[model samples]
Target: MIIGIVGGILQGMEAVYLCKHAGYTSLVIDKNPKAPAMYLADRSETCDVLKEPERAKQIFSECDAVLPAVEDLEVLEFLDSAMKEVGKPFLFDLESYRTSCSKEKSNELMARLGTPIPQPWPECGFPIIVKPSSQSGSIGVSAVKNEEQRLRALEKVAKLNDTPIQQEFVSGKSVSIEVIGNGKTAKAYVTTEVVLDSNYDCKQVVCSSNILPEKDDKEFVEIGKALGEGIGLKALMDVEAIYTKKGLRVLEIDARIPSQTPACICAATGINLLEELVCSKLGKESGKVRKDGCAIYEHYVIRGSALYTCGEKEFSHVEAPEYIKDFWGADEAITDFKTGKYEWRATVIFTGKDYQDAVHKKKQFIKNAMDNCELEEYIDRTPEMV
Candidate 1:
């Protein structure tokens, strides 16, 4: 099948990767010809959908389905309308996306559903998280310990012309689960652990059978289902949460295709989310079963003589990366690495029999890179509070 993917950035890269795994032809469209995913797709077009709606519609008509791999509301709505006019299935939910885009709205929905979430600021005390309600990832987010820091964080959000959401800083294992729905019902997929860098951007995703305790894992699945059904989600969405000592506290929800976790989940479990979504649209099941496996997906940047474990933001700077198998010691990688290149980036994937086995392979990957590149140092940084 030919899948038309819009917006060739991080999420676009993700859609292209999934299409590759599912044996589907990917056609990536982006205004910038040099967008990272443009090179990775089977076909690519350089066009801004909002600027040229007719041209976008014409391109999408040739594909079996269209998927919007962007968070911009304007672009997404344009693609939604274009897909509708073209009479093709658009793998996105605009209404659910409207709700999920704002932390204020989604937080209210979760609260009404009795899903655990971090307490509101002032009520929960110092060391709070102040973030923009509409921004994705770690953009315009801050961990503030006092009134002064809180004010500064608020100013940062104001600069983006966005509302600020203040919540108590909930620290624990960061976990995520994806859900797919057909409006009436929904299904939750595997859970993955999210590791963040010092800037609070995701640096790694670890997927395994034991990401959460059995009871918590079940609860997490139920939470994902509740949120999905609560929003009447029609496409795909992911729920992120912190598995704290008290219980599971949901962080936020994004009613769109996510970048990192799904890739890791696919590597660990045989079930491909994109394939399942497509099957659901056709009133069919993918018939793919899950396996008790483990996988680690991590990003790294090589600058000068140092190899640094980096976040998605840093990795996004990758230019015309290629997909490589058996990259270094890892199973596969999407990287810009070339022989004798002093600067490059890679998103490496490692799959194994269990979590420990995956970690062993990950260590070996690092060692191989160090030896092959003759790197002086390997650095991994983490958030100070977490």
Candidate 2:
């Protein structure tokens, strides 16, 4: 069957990869002609997803399903409406998509449903995480330390043209929940703890280091699965949570496959999200999947902007193998190439003896890689005392 895929950036590329991997033909559309996913797609159309619904519908008419790979909520919402009009295959109920797309609304829903969530406030809280409920890549997310900081942050975020939610910033270990949803049911694929590279914000996300299977928190997984099932999630979903003194509080619930999720889940477990997504769309039962050992996905954050000076010693040349594998003939990679504003992008997927060791190894790789590379202009943002 053919899948009509939308968006064509990094996340879009990943979605296309998954669809092709599942043996499905793909029709990809994006505004950028140089979108990475276009490289391997069966067919492509360069258009703005928001203004080209008719064009998208024409493309969707030839496909079995229309799937959105990007985190653009407006486009997804439009697609949802169009899917209803055409009576085509889409995973979730439109209402569920609406609820999940809004961070503020999702928090309200989950909280009312008895899911643990951090206290949310539109205002009146310091050290708050100011995030646009719909944006991704942590685009506008900021930690405000005081009232003055909150006012300044709000003013800055106001220019973004989206309503922002301010909530208490919980500092502790961060984890991600990956789930695949059939229209009626969703199963938790795996839970992984993520450590942001030291230069995480600069590179956007250099790489994800460790995927510690949450065998210890099966109940939490069950709860999240119920949450997805309750919401009628039909596609891939990712819930990011932070472990705080209060407990496990969900930070964000994305109704689409997360960026780098393949490296996080598929690399850790044998379950491929793309296959599961196809199965879900076809109403097939997803088999039981579990994580083995510990898997890591690490990437490097080269300099992006020339706002800050780069250290000459920061950039070094090292010979790293192009690929590494965990199973027989199962190709996994430590790094990949992307010609963005940065110099290099790599991710290493490997299992460790335990969580700590897994994290240690991942950090070691980042440190070593950074040590060898020369930092060019560092992005100048607000520097704080850590």
In order, candidate lDDTs are: 0.92, 0.62
How well does candidate 2 match the true structure in TM-score terms? 0.73
* Deviating ranges (above 4 Å) for candidate 1: 382-386
Q: Write the per-residue lDDT of candidate 1 for residues 152-233, one digit (tens) a residue.
A: 9999999999999999999999999999999999999999999988788899999999999999999999999999999999
Model 1, C-alpha of 240: deviation from truth (Å) = 0.6
**Residue 248 alpha-carbon offset, candidate 1, angstroms:** 0.3
TM-score of 1: 0.97
Clashing pairs in 1: none
lDDT of 2 by residue, 1-386 (tens): 88777876556555665665567787888887766567557888887867777877777788888777765667777888888777778744556667777887898878777887777765436567777776665667778788788777787678887788888888767777777776677787666666553322322111122323344367557767978887878677777787776668788787776666565566556566777777777777658355455565544334443222111112112122133343221234433333353544343444554556556765564444444443344342323211
Worst 10 residues of 1 by lDDT: 377-386
